[model samples]
Target chain A: MNFPELMGLAFVGLFLGLMLGSAFYYRNRPAPFVRQIPAFGRVRRAIGLAVEAGSRLHLSLGRGNLISTRSAVAFVGLSILDRIARSAAASDRPPVATSGESTLAILSQDTLHDASKFMGADYDPLRGQLTGLTPFSYAAGAASLIHDEATGASLLLGSFGSEVALITEAGDRTESLTLAGTDNLTGQAVLYATAQEPLIGEETYAGGAYMGAGGMHQASLIAQDIFRWVIILALLVGAVLKLVGVL
Target chain B: MKFPFSVAVAIGIGLITLAGYFLNIPVLQTLRMALIEWATTLAAVALLVGIANLFTIHWNKLTSGKVGGLYSAILIVSLVLTLGVVGWFGPTHTYSKWIFNNVQLPVEGSLLALLAVILVVAGVRLLRLRSSMLSIIFIITAMVILLATGPLFGISVPGLTELRSWIAQVPAMAGARGLLLGIGLGIVAAGLRVLIGSDRPYRG
Candidate 1:
């Protein structure tokens, strides 16, 4: 292979390794997945039903700053958008995406456009709006729009702190089908979300596959699982060796 | 007009952000510097807004003599004093550093230490919370990362540094890159979506 090809292969290998590791870590806790499955199923059903009902789906990228790891998690949410947009395209409706950061605002817009284009559907990017930058302001804004009866389904994914509760509560109040995820450990926020069975920690990584992106994502997730076990074994060995004074 | 304005701003910023990926670009570098300057100004405004919000919330609470009124009063006092001192003398001044080192650092450190304790306790008790193979892997990897990252592991051990370096450089970096690519794609898509008017986040 050429140098670039070699580097590409190496990078792919590393990505797969990390994904396997994460997947393994996630498999340890099945309760969240078990809880998320039915919710996603409901969302899928809602989306299908909404297409017939002429309702739009809502997706939020959260209020995470660009420098944060949560912003990185927002990519997973975008992957979901890719799927949601495609599904919406096949149907009569389109999904609405909202983001807190300027960067994410642009991304949400692009994702919607491209997903539609790739699916051979017509989509106008001007429809996507840039919400407020402040967490509370963004939440309140999103809450107001989503309260509209036309919004049939809601997905809250990405980096969020205590604001998760406010947004999720809004969705709940509207009785919109919602699937939420965040890695933030703020107590009340987490309690509010978990009560609704939101995906936690690494499970947020599964956003792509859950949205039907492709098998490669699932493959990456599986790879993450395997690497996670490898790390565990290494840790156990290291601990045992330390105990025995073999080092 | 609103969506178009936001989309135009987004496309301009996105290009600059992408250009920032490369270490060298005079225009991009200038733009970044300008952006930072603007951001610093905006941040100052945000700080003012936050203070206003705090006072509004607290003053109402104090007038109503709510349960958290005293806490708000204490907060206002502390915030005013700290801001006063820092504004009078720069943050790097001896008195400022003293306050930071003695008061702020300790409080923050104690809070972090408390979190560490809670995490460890929760980790132990919740070890069996999820018995799935994936959960085992996650817990195990987390423990390894935690131990390896801690000073208790003793960096003097042979191969320890190498292993840590390898894990960070190879696996972590790779995963981070893939994630970055995925994020880049999503960002591009979102921007286009906004430009085309498919998703409306600006409407309240």
Candidate 2:
């Protein structure tokens, strides 16, 4: 392999080792406490409020193609979906999940089904919906769905584009709470400006862990923190070396 | 041992795919390609399923005398008519192209325009929503960029253009790269969690 490939492989290996070690060790103990993130707290509160109000909750999983790396962000959305679906199992109005991708739609349906099954109920396939295929199309579809359902809150966590503003605007019109995050830079920027509670940077990926998905999710955060410092240190050292002409 | 079949399958596929990325084995490459193909096919099929679900929901809304029944009816009619027309003719046919160019394109364009307006509104509203030092800085930077994007009534201001470019290229790019690094690590750790079967997002 070339230098870049070799380096990438090494990095991946080191990450895997660190994550596995952390997950194993933390499994038997109380997982590390997650830092305070209001977006996640809003999600939990939104679920509870939607249930109590007997109003619908909208979860917009942006069109993240599963065959690609975008699926990682979409998976985080599904993880949140699983949690909310389970949490609101007994509510009259269950949460509605809208996605741009068909695969995400299916996984969302499966997530709702699993949650329903765990709660001894049947899931409505219509709840986990594929709204549209393209970016704006997805945004337009999800925006309308939000208004149509009279959603009490909107949790937009996925791989959206700048069109995320449309969904957040819908939430604004409805006066509903909006907590949004995405891996797309444009989406993140638009959401930061528009979403009621914006999750910036790595905050979007930390959703599952913050939501208490499982010990593994928490472990992933730990691994991320450690490796992040390692990268920062590497960058700093390289910068210093260059400054000193020591390369 | 009580084995979880689905978990095992997921983990196995994940491992093979992960290995394929780092290793140069012909057998692993072929397996990875096959798995990816299967995934693509499944995604396509899932699209169909998603469409069916959407149709079902609208159908239910129409028949159940819901408040939005008429809109749902119009949507269904439009959907069916478009599908029938497009299917009858090849996707590249004139009729299909006309529908896309005239209908879908315009609708998307309008939404895009609305998005621009909404973003500006949101930007202005940011101060009212949460006035902080960061918000102040964001507004100032945004105003500077917008004003400096072009000359003031065709008069180029000295240094302002350079200032805008520097802000856009330097601070913005740096912040973006920092976020990207964090996002990359997050994806890695999350993917690893799934690969190790500690996180099963697909179980349902």
TM-score per model over all chains: 0.50, 0.96
Per-residue lDDT tens digits of candidate 1, residues A146-165? 76434788887766655445
TM-score, cand. 1 vs. native: 0.50
lDDT per residue (tens digit) for residues B1-204 in model 1? 344566557556645754543436687778877776675576456545545544554566568886656765875686678788899999989888887888766765664554455445444433454356744654565566666777874455566557777777887566555444444333333333333333333321
Model 2, B102-148: lDDT tens digits are 99899899988998899899999988998999888988998899899
DockQ of each: 0.04, 0.78
Runs of candidate 2 exceeding 4 Å displacement: B1-3, B150-152
Model 2 residue pairs with clashes: none
Candidate 2, residue A49: lDDT: 85
Report the C-alpha lDDT of model 2 over A103-154, residue by residue, as the tens digit: 8888888888889998987678889887777788778778888888899999
